[model samples]
Target: MTVALMWEARASDGRGEELLAWARAQEFPREPLRRETLRAPGDRVLVITWWDAPYDAELPELPEPDGELLTRAVHRWRFESVGDG
Candidate 1:
C-alpha cells in the first residue's frame, strides 16, 4: 500500500507568493511516487506527496518554514490507499 502525506499552510498578509516559492524550493527527505501542489483563494498552499511505504512507516517530513512567513503553524495529515478505486 501507499501512503500520502499532506502538508498545508497559510501565508501571512501579502506573502502568498513568497510562501509558495519557499515551498517549491524545499527538498523532501526521500523521493515520492507522486507529488502535487495546490493554492487556494485565501493565500493557502497545500502539498501532497505519495510514498511507497506502509502506513506506519517512519518517513521524513518537510521542515516547518520560518515563522515570519506564515499566519499560523503548518497543518499536516496522512492517508493510506484503500485500494478500492
Candidate 2:
C-alpha cells in the first residue's frame, strides 16, 4: 500500500517569504515529496507538503528556524494503495 503524508503550517503576516524559503531548503530524502503554499481563508499563511510514502517511515529531520511566526501548525496524513479507490 502507498500513503501520502501531509504537513500543514501557518505563519503570521510579513513572515511568509522567510518561512517558505526555509521550507524549500529542507532536505527530506523521502521519495516524491511536493510542497505547496496557500493563503489561509481566515488568518495566517499556509504551507502544505505531500510525500509519496507512509508517514511512519524514516524521513529527514526538518530544519528548525531560530524564530518562527507560525501561530498555528498542524500535521496529518492519508493512506491509499496504488489503484485503490
Candidate 3:
C-alpha cells in the first residue's frame, strides 16, 4: 500500500509568498513517489507527498517553519490508498 502525507500551514498576515517560498526550499528526509504544493485563498500552503509504505509505518515530515512566518501551528494528516482509484 501507499501512504499520502499532507502538511498544511497558514502564514501570518502578509507573508504568504514568504511562507510558500520557505516551504519550497525544504527537503524531505526521504524521497517521495509524488509531491505537490498548493496555495489557498487564506494565505494557506499545503504540501502532499506520496510514499511507498504501510499505513502505520513511520515517515519523515516537513518541519514547521519559524513562528514569525505563521499565523498558527502546522497541521498534518496521513491517508493510505484504498484501491485502484
Candidate 4:
C-alpha cells in the first residue's frame, strides 16, 4: 500500500517566508518515497510526503514549528492511495 501524510500550517503575520524556509530545512530520520512542499496565500504552508508502507504503519512525520512562528497549531491528515485514473 501507499500512504500519504499531509502537514499544513499557517504562519504568523508577515512571517510566511520564514516559516517556509523552516519547513524546507526539516529533515526526517529516513526519507520518504516522495515529498512536496507548497505555500499559499494567507501565510499557509503545506507539506505532503508519500511512503511505500501499509496504511496502518507508523511513519515519520514533520513536527510542529516553534509556537512563535505560527498563528495556530498545525493540521495533519493521512490517506492511502486508492487507484490511478
How does each model score on TM-score? 0.93, 0.55, 0.94, 0.97
lDDT of 4 at 62: 93
What is each predicted model's overall lDDT from 0 to 1?
0.89, 0.53, 0.93, 0.97
**Predicted structure with the largest TM-score when compared to the true one:** 4
Which candidate number would show the highest lDDT if scored against the true structure?
4
lDDT of 1: 0.89
Error of 3 at 4 (Å): 0.4
lDDT of 2 by residue, 1-85 (tens): 3444445556566676666666666655654555565555433334455555564655443434456556555444454546636
- lDDT by residue for model 1 over 27-74, one digit each (tens)? 877789988889998899999999999999987677679769999999
Rank list by lDDT: 4, 3, 1, 2
Give the residue spans of candidate 4 off by over 4 A.
none
Model 3 compared with the native: what TM-score? Answer: 0.94
lDDT score at residue 47, model 2, on the 0-100 scale = 43
lDDT of 3 by residue, 7-64 (tens): 9999999899999999999997779999999999889999999999999999989999
Candidate 4, residues 1-29: lDDT per residue as tens digits?
99999999999999999999999999999
Number of the candidate with higher lDDT, 1 or 2: 1
